[model samples]
Each structure stands twice: as structure tokens, then as C-alpha cells.
Target chain A: MWGVATGPLRRRAVAQNLSTTLGCPVLLLLAQGYDRPSYVDVALVLALLGPIGTLVFARLLAEDLDEDPPRAQALTWAAAGFAAAVVLAVCVATEPGRAMVKLLVTGALLIGGNLVASRALARGMPTAEERHG
Target chain B: MDDALIAVALLLVAATATAAVATRDPVHQALVLSLLGVALALLFTVLQAPDVALSQLAVGSALTPLLLLLSVRKVWRRRQRQGRTE
Candidate 1:
């Protein structure tokens, strides 16, 4: 299914997925919306954090942006290892049923793949002119 | 696979996402990215997460875009100072 979609479409899907999934946390704020006049303000905080988080990540990975040999390989392997560990741990857990396990695993893979792909694309991006205007 | 709404929701998300990525101007990108956020909020509604939809609408759709536009303008100013078009 993913093979057919263009690159940016895939990336957008990833972004949307991340926002919606991570947004699960926003549910807690719903109960407090009445008492807290600033529930919306809380949501704003998370949204701002997402992009800021991305920028910080970009900064952290700046050294590897120039296509360093060893570091790039290490980063990829590290991401892969993290993904593997999460999925493996979930599979080993006794609580979730098969259906829930499947859903969890798929969600994890989607998020992991998105992060890895976005980082790669960001690194490979040409100058802002080439990327934007 | 269930309702037509889901398909339409997905398409909207796709369009907004495309806009965000395809635009060349950073200001334009910010606008498109904002649209993506709005569309994402709508998607949350389709997914039956009303709380999420509301929060996304408030934050991602509205505030984040404003901030991004402001930041983009600032970046533009800095670029003009540095004599760079991008």
C-alpha cells in the first residue's frame, strides 16, 4: 500500500499519524476543560513543542547532515534497534490480546519509519531555495 | 474501508500534507503546514476522537500556524539582512 504513495504524501501521513496518536494524551485535558479555562492553551503548548522538537532534533543531527560515513550508519542502526526492542517487548508482554498487539506494533512501525524517513529527507534536502523558494 | 468519510478525510490530509511539503516559499510552506494541521484535526474527528479534534483545532490548526507565520517573517527579515533570498 505504501509503495504507491508519493514521498511527501507518505511523510504527511506520518505527521498526521503522529499528531493524532500522540494526541491521545489530550484526552486527559478534556475532563479539566471546564475547570481550567486554559485547556486550549495546553493544547497550544503541545503543538508548539512538536515543531520545536523537530528543530532541536535537526540541530542535534546537524553534524551528520553532511553525510558522515560512520555516524550515519550508527544512527540508522540505533533507530532500527530501538524499533526492534519496542516491538519485541510488546510481543513478549502478556496483557494485550492479539488484535491490540497487532495495532500497537503497526503504530510503532509507522512512527518509527516516519521519523527515520523524515530525518533522511531532511538531511538530503538541498538548499532552502531548492526545497522551498 | 468503512465509510466514505474516512476516504475523504484521508484525501484531505494528503492534500494538506502535499501543500506543506511542495511549497517553496517558507512563508507559503508555513501556511500550507497550517492547513495540514487543520485537516489533521478534521481527521481526528473522523477517527472518533472529539477531544483530540478540539485540541488539534485549537492548537495545531490555529495557534501553531500563527506562530509559524510570525517566525517565518522573522526568518525572512534575518535573510534580508544577510542578503539571502531563501
Candidate 2:
């Protein structure tokens, strides 16, 4: 919904990051049914990379994004909240151990990275002239 | 139950692939392609191949779109410069 609803490049990038990092991980974890805890590693990588992906789009498409910077504060927070809820739920399901810690770290990265990425996109990257000067 | 998940993921992949192909603009195609990457990763996960899904997520989710958009930007800049000079 978020990806399709937004027309702006930056907004779509955020949506893509959110879906890939938070949404898919949670769904994949649930589908995995905790059969192999190693699967959580996939989410870990995604949590780490998804926002960086958005940052790439923000930096490269600065001019396009500058004209219509997305102010998606509400949506970003909602996604973060959802990530928190999913993490808490998964932690509850798993035993209190290293795996749980890993999940927590992934959750933190997912939420923190997402917020940072969204803010970066909203602020827009410095133009080449501003950067060089 | 697993079948349901697989079916949903397959449907998503199909839809996004079609959207990516149907889109005319390179920029829009890149966006759809990113989404398509996510969808494919989901399908791979549902099929019980986290390793494959991991690589797909890494390559598809960010790398592919980054490369595509970067090239598009470069091409557009060159075209604009040529247009100005001509």
C-alpha cells in the first residue's frame, strides 16, 4: 500500500526499504516457524542494508527529491511501531538466549535505520555545488 | 498452510514482474523492479531457501535498484549535456 500509494521517488524508496527490511523479515520468520534460527540472519542483513539502499536513492536522486521531499512522519513511525511489535512477539516466542538478542538487535537496526533513512530523504541531500563548496 | 503462503508469494512475484515490464519509464521501471526483487525474495523464503533468499534480498532489494537508478541518472545527465551543446 505504501509503495503503490506514493508517487515520489524518495517515498517509494522508503516504502521499499520498509517492506524489504521489516515486513518481509517478520513474514519470513513466521513462515519459518522457528525451525531454523539461522533464518533470522536474513532479516539481520536486510535490517542493515534496507535503509542504506534508501540512502543511496536519496543521495543519487537529490534533485528529484528536493522538488518534492516526502514528509511521512506518521507513516515512518507506524512502520517502526510495527517493527517493534513484531520483534517483541518473536522474542516472546523464542527462548531467552543469544537468538533473542540477535532479534532485538535486528529490530533496533530496522527501526533506527528506517527513521534515519526517512529523515535523510525528507531533508534531501546537499546539492553537488553545496557539497563541493 | 505453506501452500497458501507460497501461492500468495507467487502471485505477488507475477504481478510485480508484469508491472516492471509494463512500466515505460526507466525510473518507474527501477521502482517496480525493486519491489519485484522483494517479492522474489519473499517467494524464495516461502520455499524454504533462506540462503538463496538472503542473496536475493541483498542483490535485489538494494544493489539492483541502486545500479539501475545510478545508470539512469548518468544517462540522463549525459543526454541533457548533449542536448545543451547541440
Candidate 3:
């Protein structure tokens, strides 16, 4: 979060995207550790909504970001993998059931949204010549 | 284990909240606030309040940042307009 708050526009977008990708699994682990299935809904919501939030930033700040967009392909993939591993582990622990389905859904959404946000942030910015011309 | 989980979540909440406050730029602040929102939601979940966590996730993750960034954009645009007019 601080990473997002104290950097250039590119870095801030990257940090915001990364946090969304990463926060979902932490929420999942919290749900599993607490033995509260309902709590998983929080993870679900975050997974679904976090990227939308980043997209909000990207769209709202498009002109500012068009100067030098940020990219985090590696970080985004790593975060997605982490989310997959956590969701899988929680699924294994909880066994096959409706809850397991929900966990898988959350993981998918988290990874998908992370990728989308990362791609958006990584879009090429206008070069100086392009901006001036 | 429960105490440990709760402690960790609380610690994260504290750290992220501090980072959010310490940030200077409005854009950066918006980004940090989103992270803070996630941290707070996690804390709520750990403390056995999913309802609170759910609302926190909704408001903190998207709405707050959206409002902040939108307002920032607006202010900048207004300033740009004034500069152009002048």
C-alpha cells in the first residue's frame, strides 16, 4: 500500500495492482485458519473488486499515466501463482464441497483481475515526441 | 493459533495504516488507502466480523480510492483549465 502511495504514477499503479492480487489469498488463509466458511466471502469480494478499483485508477489517471506507464508482468504472475497455491491448499483442507467451489472461484477472479490490472498499467505511454507532436 | 492470527492481522493493519498516512501525494495516498482498506478488511475477518469485513472491502477497496482519485483528477483539471484561461 505504501509502495503505491509514495512512488511515481507508474509505480503507484503497479503497487496497487500487486496489492489486490496478493491481498486475496491472505484473506483466504484468514478464512481457513479461523474455520469460518462465511468469512471466505470477504476474499471473494476483494478478489472480484480489487482489480476494478485499480481499473478505476487507470482510467481516471490515464493521461498522467500515458507519460510512462508501469509494467509488472513477473510480479503479477507470481502473485497469481501465490493466490492459486493458497486457494488450492485451502480447498484441499476444506475438502470438495460448495465451499471448495467458492474458493476456486475466488482464486480465478483474483488472478484474472490481477492480470487485467497489470496489463492496463503496463500499457506503453506516449513518448516525448508523440506527446509534443 | 487464533491469537497469533489476530496479532498478525492487527500488526498489518497498523503498519499499512501508518504507510497510508505517511504518504504525501494525493495519488499515492489513494493507492495506499486501497491497501489499507484491504488490511482493515482482513483485520475485521480475523476478529470474527465478516459483515464488517465485507462492508470494509466494498468501501475501502474501490469506493474510497475511486472518490479520491476522481477528486484529484478533477482538481488538477480545474487547475489546468484556470492556467489555460489565464
Sort candidate 2 into its docking category: medium
- Give the runs in model 3 whose Cα sits over 4 Å from its true position: A124-133
- Interface C-alpha root-mean-square deviation, candidates in order: 11.1, 2.1, 1.4
Global lDDT scores for all candidate models: 0.47, 0.76, 0.84
Report clash pairs, candidate 1. A132-B24, A133-B24
Question: What local lDDT score does residue A89 receive in model 1, on the 0 to 100 scale?
Answer: 48
TM-score order, best first, reads: 3, 2, 1
Best by lDDT: 3
Chain B TM for prediction 2 = 0.94
| Candidate 2 chain A least-lDDT 10 residues | A23-32
User: Candidate 3, residues B1-86: lDDT per residue as tens digits?
Assistant: 77897898899889888887788888878888888888888788878898998999899888998889878878998999999999
Model 1 chain A: weakest 10-residue lDDT segment is A1-10
Q: Tell me the spans in candidate 2 whose CA falls farther than 4 Å from its real position.
A: A31-34, A126-133
Once fitted onto the true fold, the runs of candidate 1 whose alpha carbons sit more than 4 angstroms away are: A1-133, B82-86
The sequence of per-residue lDDT tens digits that candidate 3 reaches over residues A1-133 is 6566566779878887888788788888878777878888889999989999988888887887887878677777888889889988998899788988998898888888888777876774445787885
**TM-score (0 to 1) for chain A, all models?**
0.33, 0.82, 0.89
Q: Point out the higher-scoring one by lDDT: 2 or 3.
A: 3
* Candidate with best TM-score: 3
Q: What TM-score does each of the candidates earn? A: 0.37, 0.89, 0.90
